[model samples]
Target: MISIRRFPIRIALCFLVSFPLWGCASIAQWAAPEKKATTSAPVEFVNAEQEFWTHFHAGHYDRIPQLLETYKRLYVLHPDHPVIAARIGFLHVWHLSERMRMGEPKASVIDDATLCRKFFGEASQLDPKDPRFKGFYAACIMAEADIHQREADTRKGYYLMKDAISDWPEFNLFTGGYVMSQLPWEGSLFDEALEWQWKTLDLCAQTKVDRKQPEYPAYATQDFSGAKRACGNSAIAPHNFEGFFLNMGDMLVKKGEVPVAKKIYSFARLSPSYQQWPYRNMLEDRIRKAEENLPYFRIQKREEISSKNPHLMFHSEAACMACHRTND
Candidate 1:
């Protein structure tokens, strides 16, 4: 029961003609009715869906398996509900592929790539052209690329990412394309990666503008929040605040911004979220060395010091002799 709007040409023309004079007043009146209607109805959902969202927001990753099982039971009772199917499929990717939480000890679970493939495949089959399904399917392909990389099948990974980019152009698929193009191929991959990065950046900029348009889908709005956080807002400063700073700092170090990079890397070392990341220790060591060498590299120049002392002797030996002469 999605709402669709249609206006006859005559009505549209009249509305357009009157819009300048009456638009604000009409919008105010329309808003009251909408607000009343929204407030009159109680928000309700299937008990399992409610439970799933509750656990999700609570960060109960360890309990996701049990919650998912309950969702499966509800699904059996309501096989025709595409929304529920989509939710379950999306959660499988969030927990399995994204590893939104750490895995449990001794729990033999299916790898993320396989779980993502199965769920997204089923979801897309159930509801073709559902943008949510397409987005999740793209995610599954990207997860598979990661799995392929781990298994040393770089060619398979690259192709999978390329297919994902082609299939889900709206969901930052160019990022996947960029990653695929950057696979360690004896430095031949740089140009390909740069091409994809440029394409991705351009697409993201266009998508950002489109999302601000009034007619964009609600799902797009939701997905765009995370994407915007990742790419758009400079105030949030992703590398400085998130777990990304460590890697970014390392890149800066390699680019020769030693002092500023070390400061950033030092902050990353102290971030609790990044404690388990592989680069934590390396960043810490780099910070220590940078701090230890700060005095030598950052000391005031001898010329500047000498300029402040107009009558001081130029040579070290002469200066020592002048101080030690003791009014002789």
Candidate 2:
């Protein structure tokens, strides 16, 4: 809920919402249902190459080592294949993200981000014309911002993320991610964050995806996995980013804008994509917490009652009942 009550501190112009987590949705639609993945490929090469995705999505990283080798061999064999190059790059970032998820030390996270940046750099080079590759490359670089890089370099990466947004405004992942990065540096990004989040909601609301072009050689028909199926059929359903709402609510809460935070949390809880996130189940609880936290609830005491040796208590009737919907 956008509010009319303005604050002396940063409000519309400057707001940064921080809830840390790895970006999860595919560059395009992520789910592939028609092709059920098996541990063993009936065809050795196809099975070997796509085996990674099963383990990847199924949360089985132990198999990732073998999958990495298989992708390496495939990339070498097919040097011109953009998907192979991109997958290799994607894996490097994924490996680093998973490490961070496990509470890996900051030093280790920084080290992995270093490798991840290099991999995405190679991916962008491998597919120089695709904005997707360039965007992913920039996103990977952003991981190291303020964590492993100097302030100037982090600022440079921030501008690069802005460039990525310019390159593809239709892509909400980069837009929302860029907004996240900007909130800390620029309070003006508050308006921009709202603008982008609303646009993202529209993008997520759309039923169709416009991948536009597909490379036949880019796909391994034998195994529907990785970058291919993630974007193959434009008909594949789009994923919602309830996380974007979560992030916005977090920003509002940090600013003590409970009204707006409540609205955002409410909207987020209603999203189908909310169910997919780890915090989805917790959203309503957060909303109630925000409701309870709003200012000027009833306070009652009889200690100073008309000098009658009773306690004194006062409650802001309007404020107390403002957030309460129950009859009681």
Q: Which lDDT tens digits does candidate 1 get at residues 1-328?
A: 3234544666778888888669788788877732110112113335666776555544455666787677666566555556656666756655553231242212233465566666666666666555446555654665565545454444544564555556555333433432332133224453364345335434544543221121212222222344444322222222222233333333333334566556545544333334334334444655666544333322234333222221111111121111111111
Q: Which residue pairs collide, candidate 1?
A: none
Best by TM-score: 2
Per-model TM-score versus the true fold: 0.42, 0.54
The C-alpha stretches of model 2 lying farther than 4 A from their native spots are: 1-49, 61-66, 76-79, 98-100, 104-106, 172-195, 202-239, 272-279, 289-328
Question: In candidate 2, how many Å is residue 108 off?
Answer: 2.0
Best by lDDT: 2
What is the lDDT, from 0 to 100, of the residue 194 in candidate 2?
50
Q: Please give the CA lDDT of all the candidate structures.
A: 0.44, 0.46
Off by over 4 Å in 1: 1-45, 98-107, 138-170, 174-198, 206-328
Output the TM-score of candidate 1.
0.42
